[model samples]
Every structure is written in C-alpha cells, then in structure tokens.
Target: MNFPRSIRWKLQLWYGGLLLLLLAGFGFTAYQLESARQLRHIDEELQQRLPMLVDSQRPIPGDRDRRQFRLSTRDALLFDQTGNESFYYVVWLKHGEPVTRSTTAPEDVPQPKAGDPPNRLRGDVRESFLFPGPGDCVLVGRSIAPDLAGLRQFAWWLCAVGVTVFAAGLAGGGWLIIKALRPIQTISAAAQSIATGDLSQRIQTQDTESELGQLATVLNTTFARLEASFSRQSRFTADAAHELRTPLAVILLQSQNGLAADHLTEEQREAFLATQRAAQRMRRLIESLLTLARLDSGELSDNRAPCELNRVAEETVRLLQPLAAEHGASLTTELAPAHCVGNADELAQVVTNLVGNALVHNRSGVSVHVKVLIEDQHAVLTVRDTGQGIAPADISHLFERFYRVEKARTTAGGHTGLGLAITQAIVTAHGGMIVAESRVGEGTVMTVRLPLALRGADST
Candidate 1:
C-alpha cells in the first residue's frame, strides 16, 4: 500500500504498525508459555502417581506367570474414593506385556515402547513409568483435558486483550499526533495567507523550545524582512519615476520647439524629431514604472463601481483603430452588455493595453478581434489577434514583468515589456484573473474575467 501524504497519518500508521507487532509478539509468547505450563503440570501429576501405582500391585501368591498381579486394599480404597472427573489409568507390565490394569483403564490406552524414557509421552495425555522390582515396570497415564481446556481459554482471552490494546493504542496515538502537529498546521495556514498577498500576517509561536515553534519564529523573521525589502523597492521606483518626469517633459518640449522653428535646417529637423521620439519613449516607460510602483505600494485603490465592459471594449477599439490602420491591420469588435464592479479607468487601461499589444505585435493585414460578453456571471473580455503567435516556451512567462518573446522580434517596437504585468496586477486588484493562450502558427488569445456587479445583475 502507498503511504499517506499527511504527517499525522504517517505517524499514526507507523505507531499502529509497531503496536501490532508488539501485540503479536506478546500473544505468541503468552500462548507458548501457557501451553508449556499445562504440559508441565500434567507431567508432575503423572510422576507422582507412578510410584503409588507400582507399589499397589504385587505378584499373585506363588504364581509363576509374569502377567498375574493384584492391587492392595489401601491403594484400591484411595483410587475409588477420589471423585475427580479426570480419567486416569494404571498398568503393570513385564517384558513389554501388560500384567495387570486398573478397572477404569481404557484397553486402547498407549503403552511405553522399548528404549523409551521413564517420562516419555507428554501432551494433553501424559504417561510416566516406575521400575520398582526386577523385570517389573508400572505406567501411569492421566488425561489432562481440564488443563488443556484452561490453556485454550487463556489463549483466546490473550488474543482478545491484545486486539483491544492495539485498537486503543491506534486511537490514542492518532489523537496525540494531531495534538502535536497542530502548531505546524497553524504555521502552514499562515504561510498560505501570506502568499496570497497578506504579508502582514505572522506565525504566532506558543513554545519556542518546540521544533514547530522555532520554525514559526524563523518564518516570522523571514516574512518581516521580505515585507521591508518590497517596501523599499516600491518606494525607490516611485521616487525615481517622480524624479525623471520633469526632465523628460522638458526634453520633449525643447525638441518640439526646435522642430517648429522656421530657421531649422533639414538635418536639424530630423535630429529634433529623433530626440522627441526618444523622450516620448522614456516618458511612457517612466509612466509604466510609476503605475507598477503605486500598485505595489497599495497607493492605487480598486474603486468598486458599476463598469460597462462592452462600452470600455468599444472605446478601446476606436482608440487603437489608427494604430491598426498604420500597420495595415483591421480592428473589429463584438460587444455584449457586460457589467462588472471595478474602476472604469483601470478597466479601460486593461483593455487599452490588451488591444494595443494585439495591434502592435502583429504583421501587416492581420485582424485584431475584441469580444465582450457575460459568462457564468462574470464579465469576459477576449482579445484575439491573427498575428505571429507566441512560442510555446514564452507563453507561460508572457505576463511576467520585462519578459519578451524573442529579442530580435521585440526590438522593432519600443516596448518597455511591462504592459501585461501591469495589466495582470490591475485585474488581480479588482478580484479578477487573466489568461493568455497561443500556438506557433494559429494566433494569440487573451481572456480577462471580472466578477459582475451584484446590483447590476439584480437589476438585469
């Protein structure tokens, strides 16, 4: 059988298995000891009776026949007066043939063979011999049926007690394991909560000397350090983005003034145009970085309001239509009334980023299709592009910050590569999810799902 996955179950199994082995060992030892004790008791009884039986029988008066013997009056009185239910027999033998036997002796009772020891036969029925005179032997046989039955009853009781003990051990061991591992389970639950963006949660330690308590202490320290590190990084990005904004704006304005001046030569105009484009690209990169920093620092609120997703999709398509036309791509939309609870501005940004990526990352004459509908009480927005599809390996990391498909293919557009990452963060803040699917030659499809506003749904 395959082992269990939980530590509690594994501990219970091992403990139960060990207890079973112990019980089995103890039962076997008890059974052997009881059987031996009964046999030893029978042997003692047979030994005591042999001499008396031999003494009781004597040779008949002047009889030369070896088979002739008689019991004394005292021995006959003693044997007949005993009321014990255990059947016993005595026999006198000479030269391996019976000379006399007691009245109650069974004719078929086993006799000792030649060369056998005095106390040879031992079992439920035991036999012992006595040599009192020359060429004369006496054999005593006793039925140990009472003792045998007592031993058998003891064996059954031992088995019953062993089974009861084993069952109790399993239950008690399982409870103890659960109690011992409760701290570890708490730690695991805290770790899961922290992983789901609640870094404020910490493991509470009850006993520092215990292993789980020590682990909790270490994990609490690690989480504190991680939260501080993330805070510092977020602050640094926000500061840098804020610092670069003014300079980029000045650069753009100066380049625009130079381009509009009447005295500028052709070479000068081209240079100024290039400078303006570079400044604009830098500004867009800084803005994306600032948005991500705010998201990380929890400064941007997910303002919950009724948002019509179909309206957002239609606007985003219209806004990106010029870019698609410039690349010889067609923009089409299939919109249904889909309403969700989110910030309209952020949802618009999400649609803009998706549609913009589709249009910019496509070959000429490719079609970009946008769809908005309600599925399973969630607003579903899908953007599909008939462009060069993503590589299989790159699809998983597409939403990761600054990850690009192929360096050469991505270099043509001045993409900062933070679009999908920001889009995912915004969707997650709104309690939604986004997924991307692509094949080598087919195309790419990005699906976004947001929970529908309860009030809007009720009204509908």
Candidate 2:
C-alpha cells in the first residue's frame, strides 16, 4: 500500500495505536480484577451463613406444622422474608437424601452430585457453600442478578471512558505533531525564498536547544555568508568592468589612428584593424558585464513604465531587418496591443538579442517570427525561429552567465555569451518570466510573459 509521505500521519498512527493498546489493557485488567473480587465477596458471604443455615434446620419449639425454624418469627436476616436479601439454603441427611430446606431455597437444586464443589453457583445463584457435619450437609447461596447487572453497566462505563480518552489522546497527538514540524515548515519556506534569489531570508531562532533550532541557526549563518559572498562578487564585477572602460577606449583610439595612417602597408592596416576590432569586442563584453552587475543590484527597478509590447516588437523587427537580410533569414510578426510595465529599452534589448541570436546562429533561409499578444493579465512576447535548435541539456543553462550552446567564449559575431542572461535578469526585474522550448533539428522558441499594465495606470 502506498501511504502518503507525511510524518504527521505516521506519528499519529503509531502514537494512537500504542495509546489504544494501553487503555484496552488497563480497562481489561481493571474489569477482570473487579469481577473476581465481587465473586469472591459473594462466596465469603455464602460460607459464613452455611453453619447458621444448618442450625436453623431444627423445627421450632411448640410449632404445630413441625417444619424446621431457627426461631419463631425470626429476623429476615436469616432467610430474607422481611427484606431484599435473597439468601437461601438446602439441608441434607447423611445418606445424601434431602431433609429440609428454607422457603426461599430453589426446588431445582437436586441431591449432592458427585462432582459438586464446596462453594458453587447453581443456575442464577452466585455462590452455594456445602457445610458437611456429623449429621447434616447444608448448601447456602443467593441469586446474583443484581451483581451481574451492576457489572454489565460497569463494563459499559469503562468502554465509554476508554473511547473518550483514546479520542482525546489522538487529537492531542496530532496537534503536537503539527507543532513539532512547524519549524521545519518555516525553514522550507525560507529556503524557497532564498532559492528564488532572495538571499536575505533567514529562519527565525525561537528555540536554540532543540535539534531543529540548531539546524536553523546553522542555515542562517550559511545564508549570511552566501549573501556576503555574492555581494562581493557583484561589486568586483561592476568595479572591474568600470575600470576597464577607459583603457579599452584608449586602445581602440590608438588602433583606429594607426589604421588611418597614410604610410601604412596593406598588412599593417589589416593588423591595426584587427586590433581595433579586438578592442571593440572587449568594450562590448565590459558593457555586458556592467549591465549584469546593475541588474543584480536591481538598479533599473525605478526605470519602469507602461509600454506597448507590439510597438516594441515592431520597432525591434524594423531595426534588425537589415541584419536579417544579411543572414538570409525571413522575419514575420503578428502584433497585438500587449501593454506591460517595464523599462522599454531593456525589454527592447530582450527582443533584439533574441531576434539577433536567431539571425546570427542559424542557417540561411531560416524564418524568425516575432509575436506580441496578451493572455489574461500577462503581456506575451514570442520569438520563434526555424533555426538549428538547442540541446535539452544546454537549454536549462541558457540564462546562466557566460554560457553558450556552442560552448565557445568567442563567436564570429562577437557574442559575449551574456545576452540571454541579461534578458532573463531584465525580465525578472519586470516581475516577469521567460521560457525556451526546443528540440534538436526542430528550431527554438523564446517566450516572455510580463505583468500587464492595468487600464489607466500611468508610467513612473
């Protein structure tokens, strides 16, 4: 059987089962002890009155009927004629023949059987003690109807109390299980937030002595260190990119001047041009790095405004048309009013990079389609290309910094491998998401969904 993987249910089952067993054992033991004690008490009473019953067997003095009696108009305590006691006895002769018996004695009690016990129950009678003497043997006993009824009621009471206690125990156990797992739930929630790029989340430390409390303390320390490490890395990248800008600009200027020299041979001109191209590529890489660092720091969060996604897609297509022509790729569009709130320039970059990627990385005659539409409350942008598709393993890492499906740092088109990563960061900043779908030899589709701007909402 496949049970749910829930610790709460498992603990409840074990705890409840154990408690039920304990209550059943206790109630059973108590009931058996009480029943035996009642029977023993009744037997003791019967034994104490057996000799009196023997003495009361003689006929009363001056009685005309000649029937045995202990006294004339005796107290009902002897045979229960005046009260509710049901005591009775039967006397027998030495030869096992019946002699006399009390008025309340049962007529069905036959002669002493071979296996008759000294103290026994006959029919409804609880206890009948045999008192054997020189001339007579008496059987003293009483009916146990009232005792049986009381015991039956007691059994029901025990059942009722046991059921109540068991139910209460199960409820209490379930509550305790939930309480015990509360810290784990808190930890999971905090960890999920951290996973979603919020490294500032920390588990609350309410009980340091517990095991889970200690674990929480360790996780908090680890998260703090992680936050600090990421902060340093971001600062370093931004600083390094900023510091390289002037040097790269100087190198580019020097190479451009050298290439424009009047006395330069053909080979020298090519060399200078190559140097200039290299410097330009380095500058673009540095710019991408700076952009990533800014995105990491959420610098463009305040630059958001309401914009039409259709306008952005149409303009981006127009801007990239020449490049698409150069690569022999077809560009298509189905524009709709897809209003969203984000930095228009960043969202445009997102479109430009996706379309440019399709154009640069695919074979000639591949078609690239740009779409802008709305689905519910989201502005949807899809850039689909009939180009060589990405591998499944590489698709997951497409947004990772400096990762490329081609696995090379430099491409003929000078891709710095940060374009898609930047696009993802920009989309995330806009409170949006992007997805890539592809199969080998079947082309790729890049889909972006941004929160739609509400009607009449103004740009910030």
- On TM-score, the leading prediction is 1
Over the stretch 1-460, how does candidate 2's per-residue lDDT look in tens digits? 2357777778888999999999999999999999999999988887787666655666557974344535235634567553335887677765666676677877887655545677766655765656455545677778887888889999999999999999999999889998998998999999988886778899997899899999999999999999999989999999999999999989998998897779899999999988988898898999999998888888866777888889988998999999999989999999998788888899889999999988888888989999998997899999999877888888889889888887412267888989999999898889899999987887999999999998998643
TM, every model? 0.81, 0.75
Q: What would the per-residue lDDT of candidate 1 be over residues 316-405, giving only the tens digit for each residue?
A: 778888998998998999999888877778888999999888877776788989999999989999999888899878888998998888
Error of 1 at 373 (Å): 6.6
lDDT against the true structure, per candidate, is 0.80, 0.83
Query: Lowest summed-lDDT stretch of 10 residues in model 2?
Result: 64-73
How many clashing pairs does model 2 include? 0
Q: Tell how far residue 402 is off in model 2, in angstroms.
A: 1.9
- Residue 188 miss distance in model 1 (angstroms): 3.1
Q: In the order shown, what is each candidate's alpha-carbon RMSD?
A: 4.2, 5.4
At residue 424, give the lDDT of candidate 1: 91
